[model samples]
Target: MRETRRQTFDEVDLLLDNARLRDELEPYRDESIDPSINRMPLHAENEYLASMLAWERAPALPIAEWFNPPLDLMPPDSLSDAQLSSLLNKTIERLFSKNIVLRCTDHLSDRELYMIVYRDILPCCEKMVDVPGKAIEWMCVEDTETWLRYYASAVERRRYQEERGMPLPAAETPPYRRQLPGQ
Candidate 1:
């Protein structure tokens, strides 16, 4: 899929909101670390990773439909603001919306966070967060940064293996560098 930095006017608001949310969520991001590198790798489940991989391949459709879709089909536009908000919140929660639990704490590397956010969080956010047009550009930036890190690590691993003349032993563990958010 083509990498893009396009953002609509409304996306600016979404971007700001997302930044704020990130700040609020930061304190609660993952803090635990696995000390034993010998244990099975803490790979995020494959289905979650697969979903993120699929997103990379899918055409970039307008995020609107995935966000605040038209409610004409549901016929509840006339509800009171409080009621509507409550219902929307429920919908958002049920849709697996991104929240404090999903944010990346300093504990996880950027790549790990990227996998968690894009795979587990973004898809859920699709039905919950009303993304601003500008945030789309930010998302693009984040996505690109994540991809580069993944690519770099893979390349480094292959290089190490070639030089060592053996499949990478545990000591060849690739260093995990956190990709800066939206860099």
Candidate 2:
């Protein structure tokens, strides 16, 4: 008869415990407690875990401190169209340099985007937590309905529709398309 070696359940349990211990030793071990962890698919969970790990190790800085020269934005109401345009362009460049990016900007006009930069973003005193390989996001503030209608993914739109118990209005593309950073 041939000799055979079989693994016991206790041995398997020991192996699993070792694996769990290794995961706990990782930088983002605490992120395992994220409520959506179980709901996400394997790949998405992996990505999220990686992002969480990066965030855990990254340095935190205020938005004002992120820039070397510091920002000098004019008040929205005081700027002419040409001045606003020039400032907006320069600001966008500066934001991109600092790994900050705008999301759902396609829903807003150029003027609206500039206004947001002048009013909401420039004046805000929030600290940015920088994660490697992740760009800080500035999403559209006004006209959320328009963003949801045109820019939100199909699944999000469907969920919104279901929650409201009414059909959503058709998506219409915005008149202007501002190129987002790190496209």
lDDT (CA) per prediction: 0.38, 0.68
List, in order, the clash count of every candidate structure. 5, 0
- Model 2 scores a C-alpha lDDT of 0.68
Cα RMSD for candidates in order: 21.6, 7.6
- What TM-score, computed on C-alpha atoms, does each candidate reach? 0.21, 0.62
The local distance difference test score of model 1 is 0.38
lDDT of 2 by residue, 100-154 (tens): 7877777666678887876677666554545457676887646657767778788
Instruction: State how far residue 100 of model 2 sits from its true place (Å).
Output: 0.6
Name the top lDDT candidate.
Answer: 2
Q: Write the per-residue lDDT of candidate 1 for residues 1-183, one digit (tens) a residue.
A: 223433444455555644564455445445332234224322322222233333444454322234455221122445555565455445434323322222222344444434443444444323232322212322222432333333336677667667777655332222443333233
